[model samples]
Target: INHQTWYIKAEWRGIDLVPRMLELFEGHHEYPVTEKVRIDVLRRFGYYSTESNGHLSEYVAWYRKRPEEIARWIDTGSWINGETGGYLRVCTEGRNWFETEFPQWLAEAPKSFAASERSGEHGSYIIEGLETGRIYRGHFNVINGSTITNLPPDAVVEVPGYVDRNGLNIPRVGDLPLGCAAVCNQSISVQRLAVHAAVTGDDRLLRQAFLMDPLVGAVCTPPEIWQMVDEMLVAGEAWLPQYADAIAAAKARLAQGKAIPTRTGYAGAARLHTKTIDEMRADRVNSQRNAEATDKAKLRPAAAKKAG
Candidate 1:
């Protein structure tokens, strides 16, 4: 099962997990994964979280928000750790890769295709546990009730749980360490407000949600935050049918010409400028792997070391 990146192979083969990871990264100057953000957090927070660099980076305020700081934390050569819009570009290229490979896969011998190794996704194992009453231990995203006492009960949390004939059964995690829970509770507040604002179409709550977001609040003033939300609503009005009235209100506010200004040049803390095909061809192997791999940070996990 895919519990954590390190735990995946360890769970199956019983390898020494955490220390092996520290040794793997012991003296590397550059990140083997999302190097800067992960290492910094591990130093700041005593516990090692299971999330890889990409997902973990977004949750914290240290890695992103300013251009100057972004360069220090980001790896230009990597997919998950590079500048802004990297995820979208990588996703688009991945789709292109699949589209190009699918016909070739179809025309190839059926036995050749069918005999390939299976994927590492947890879906198959979960099904096996539920169908045959085997116990499968892994991390699952589940709604929080009493599982984490410090977090909002309605929020979703990633935690260890087991599957069996009874289905996915989650137990109380009691409480996260003080630092981790502090981080988690911040996210829960943003998520709770964002969901409520979306469902209720409350502009006030929506603005509050932005203000509560760690990165957004750190990077923008209240008026700037509100205006940014207005711009987003007006731009994405096509999919936001419930926000028609709110969009109209925001447009009227912008029409009055009193809205706080936003920075057009702020490309985000970790975003890189787009490269042309010739530029990408300079590093064909990495470019191709960046485009093709579904989870680019698949083998890489978090590493945190304590001070003596």
Candidate 2:
């Protein structure tokens, strides 16, 4: 009767919930009014109880108050099942919903907050936003999680919740500690080129730069360099030109039968000069002992003559 009222006009799909529930609950005392029935209904609509351990209660509360708003949330990729609405139901070995869609939504989402610019460990600046700031920070593969406590407290901070057309902050722009400004004046060319290399999976340019001058490698993090290399290899031919210098240098070293030189001084020069010095000292000591014995023999004869 309920199906006739609610789903009579609805087209049958691969997994129809109402019909399945009706068939499954045909003869029980509770009939269509069981916990299983409720679970089944919620499952079909992509709803689930939030786990006690998850930190999505805020989103869950929002979802409960405005169920219809789920469409917008899902479109923005901010929605999560069990916490928020609109999650893809992918049933493989286990039932899990991936957060793959969130980044896409974040890319288009408005800036929610901004942190005061802070300096990174190696003269790098970290500018974060409060709500949407994590997106940009994560995109650059900078900091982890939400909090920016890892940043220096002395850096000047700024986090305007909203922004205007000129890309200026709306609301309030606060100052972070001065330490946050280390990378603020860094060349965009380096940052952009690095980002482009990563997105395109090209490391050839980075490798060439590093090879031509080893100091270039010191400017970026080790992980960043590895990531660029991985991407370049993945991109194949596009990275060859960039890596040409490094490759040539490697081949040259191989041909000369010389390993890459260590930063430390040469190993062979550290031989023992102590052997020659020790022998000379031993001869001097023996000569001193003989001279002392001759002087004592003369003294003993003079003492015997005085006694006689």
lDDT of each: 0.69, 0.31
> Could you tell me which 10 consecutive residues in candidate 1 have the lowest summed lDDT?
1-10
Off-target runs (Cα >4 Å) in candidate 1 are: 1-33, 97-116, 273-293, 299-308
- List the candidate 2 regions with Cα displacement exceeding 4 Å: 1-176, 183-242, 261-308
TM-score of 1: 0.79
Worst 10 residues of 2 by lDDT: 1-10
TM-score of 2: 0.20
Clashes of 2: 24
Candidate 1 per-residue lDDT over residues 194-230, each given as its tens digit: 8998899887898898999887877788878888999
Query: Clashes per prediction?
Result: 4, 24
